[model samples]
Target chain A: MTATTDQTATAATSAKLSPYKRFTPTRGNFELWSWVFMRASGILLLVLVFGHLFVNLMLGEGIHAIDFAFVAGKWSSPFWQVWDMLMLWLGMLHGFNGVRTIINDYTEREGTRWVLKTLLVVATVFTIVLGTLVIFTFDPCIDPNSTLSVCTK
Target chain B: MTATATQPSSDEQKAGAVPTFTVTLKVQRYNPEVDEAPHFETYEVTAHATDRVLDALHQIKWEQDGSLTFRRSCAHGVCGSDAMRINGKNRLACKTLIKDVNPDKPITVEPIKGLPLEKDLVVDMEPFFDAYREIQPFLITNGHEPTRERIQSQADRDRFDDTTKCILCAACTTSCPVFWNDGQYFGPAAIVNAHRFIFDSRDDGGSQRLEILNDKEGVWRCRTTFNCTDACPRGIQVTKAIQEVKRALLTSRF
Candidate 1:
């Protein structure tokens, strides 16, 4: 028999011979999903990432246009605000899941894994909270008495 | 009479011709309740040409002693169990054959370093999972459901695809020297996971996750030993992911 057939036969025989089995991973399926995800996300990333670059670099006065005032200008508009918000959320999730895979593959200690992942979640949350705050609560033109330049603007 | 006797002896020797080879296995054994200190136990097992170290362990457990214990879920190398220090290197016990480790000399097997040993070859895994969950490894969109399916191109998914293969085995994390001393350091595996979505186009939490990782124990703690990469069973390019995150942090105007 061919190798494929031989493997099939062996599997069949093993199944017949043994009734109690514990935690046999359904191989090939997880990998298949991961492969599909890479292609799909990679394409979306090209658009979102490149669009971000183009707008920041080529739009209006281009790279020279960027400054504290420029950022204030973009955040002021709801359209740009939504666009940036989407970029931040998507990029972090994708990267986080990807690294999760890396962690599962490498770390052997159960305690260590738990500790490290917990830290990752805490940090991720802290950043998201702080960043969203900065994005939303941003004050471009502040009172003249304020110490910050952006606030002074 | 002498010739007859010699011939008979030679025939008997030939009839019981089983080549006996001796292999010494030095294993580290620890029991907190029973033993005051951890000690090494050596076993000499006579194995065949096709015997693996796992097989030797079985022989030792079965014939020599029964107190020896280690974690083994799948005899095959899939479930991420059986990872241990084999001859001073991190590898799965079931995947490494005896001949490959040391053909003539004794082979040493110990629990992975940088963790508290619960018993023989079993380390506490709570800390490792803590770091994993800390990264918030989930989709956190603005709760705005798309009218249709969230459309993403093939290339967008491909950017973080290689990184998603991690199995959370802790081989990479324990292998890290930084984690050994600085428990607060996020370690390589957590950073790699954070980088996965941080760079993804579909996900939106980049700046948020980046800010979290930018802390003292975050991505900056990575010394780039490449031990996490080398020890990973899945062949993940861990160092590259860390570098990518570092680049993202540097270039972002925010």
Candidate 2:
């Protein structure tokens, strides 16, 4: 419903719109990739997290059977290890991206937002690194020398 | 032409009297045929404290330069045609009084952000209206049409009453940073219009709108910046409406 008021025959409007009071969006396909990652990882996380909960809380002796040995029992197998690792990586990445969106929306000052995002990256990297190391290098048997229990003979 | 006898002649007028002062307006000027880039041109207009920003532009066009072009109609906020950037904020000029802003300094007026600026204070609204059209923002009833008027309760009408007031001014959409960065995002105005139809009890298009909004560029694109809500002349909770559409998509419920 815009009114065509005071039309000038010679003058024309600009086809370009320069940024005003807005931060330049992430360079390249960062946002597009980030958007794709959210949807993809979200669907994967739903299955992984629910399946994990079902195993830990609904299968066998349910929640009561969960202990250090129970965790050791699961991590002993490469299949379970990979499952947990996938879950760990996907969950953290999804959560980190979601929080990053929140920070961008809420933080008015550019400096504060940059700092918060930097912190998010650091924390996510540290957690993923530490989690992956634990899953792959975990010792099922408490004693390294022992050939008993879940240890290899 | 007769000069106004009651108009204040000086800035020394008291608060109760018409306090006339000089307002420097820096308007963004662009002529595609002549200039390669947009530039600012300054104009000084005498205005009373009660005078709206539209009056200042009118003065500049009528007295200073007849070629100073812009869009305005009804001289009131109802038509939603005079929306422009008033000192960096998207606001209807007719609704903004000179005194409300810091008129002591020069005021910068530009066309709203995120749209292709066609001329001073005008943008090609085709893209914006295209998004609005894509959503199919109309009541849809799949079942047999009722011979009588379809009845709706008060609660149903009140649920979507806020979004219904949107005048499609493009204020909320242009104010959004996401819309600015990527034009593909459905923008807040489209989502808001869909919300109006989706929540209406008489409308059968809730599921259809929800499905359309479930795409990657739909409601999920809204990061809750609240800029759209701030820019909305009708005071619609734009971000909140986007959230509602998101919830509807997730739950598959209206």
Candidate 3:
């Protein structure tokens, strides 16, 4: 019994040391960072999400304030533009990080990981690009001959 | 110490022995076409301390009740047929040993949640299979096949081995809360399989598969609960695969 117990203790100690010597920290840190991000983003998300909700649902005329004109009027201000931008970026990053955590937990194959991550990055870029373009380059009142709607007006 | 002094009065003392115990199993029973509601049926079976839940079920079926019905294949846990809710968590009945669970208490067995019940301990597998088939699971190569097997490196083949371990057990898919709510969302198993071919160096279907998976209801629906990972019998990292697919979609240009 004493001999067997000694062997077990030695085995346990060696097993603990093996992983540190064998595996290199490459993308695992990225996953760790992502794990940390979920909590941090979750907290920020609580604030950003609730703020957007309050502004949209509770402030002033509330639901009645929203319209095509309302959107045009809001986008006209730099302050609203910055707020919307922050919301878009934070929301997308939070969502992207959440999905990234899911991918690391599930996808086992290296090629599969590469291909899927590539696709995710591509989609994120496309959406962000298109959304940013739409946000900044707005033409509420278009004149057939003028390049800028504000200049035409 | 003399041999005469060590001798036992009974022959039973000469044989190697250990304490034995009795365990009770409470299994849920229901026949959809006949029964009004599901009910629990208990069976008392004698088992060794190291026996698995599957072993107990086998004993009950063989000795106590011949009518007890459940699905099991590849009793060693490779085949995913025996996945069920063991004490509220999805686990392969074959893989889960009774000793690992509460051996002192009666074990409770039930079918997986969020699926239509076909009978006791068996759920309708068609919806799960349908979701799997919709992902276009087969390999699609845009280029003509080479006369010799389309050459791929050992590294490239390794990319899909993890996803291939899925036995269509529905453990991962059924554990998903999103899949429970939205039937159209491509569940974890299908996405894992899709990731297999999408990353294959020899396969040319990346763009096409991506197009199919890019809908509002596709990969975007996953909520990253990690339940599927915990439930997977083969230990396939499911959440990682979904994230990789999402990453792929994000990077691909329209």
Give TM per candidate.
Answer: 0.55, 0.68, 0.62
Q: B1-254 in candidate 3: lDDT tens per residue?
A: 24324445465533344333688888988976589998999988887666778999999889987877889998888878888888777888988878777877878999887667767898867667766776788878775667897888999989877888888888898888766653445678878888888888887888777666665445766778899898898999999988888778767742
lDDT of 1 by residue, B27-76 (tens): 99998669987899988998755677788888988998888988888767
Cα lDDT for residue A99, candidate 3: 67
**Candidate 3 Cα misplacement greater than 4 A, ranges:** A1-153, B1-19
Q: What order do candidates take by DockQ, descending?
A: 2, 3, 1
How closely does chain A match the true chain A in each prediction, as TM-score?
A: 0.67, 0.78, 0.69
True contacts kept of each: 0.00, 0.00, 0.00
Docking class of 3: incorrect
Residue-wise lDDT of candidate 1 within A5-110, one digit each (tens)?
Answer: 9867965775444322213332222433443455567777778889989999998899999987778878988887777776776666567656765565457565
lDDT of 3 by residue, A42-70 (tens): 88878877887898888999999987667
Candidate 2 local lDDT, B97-128, one digit each (tens): 98887899999999988787777777878678
- C-alpha lDDT of candidate 3 relative to the true structure: 0.75
Candidate 1's C-alpha lDDT? 0.74
Model 1: runs farther than 4 Å from truth? Answer: A1-153, B1-22, B48-51, B147-149
How good is chain A of candidate 2, measured by TM-score?
0.78
Better candidate by TM-score, 1 or 3: 3
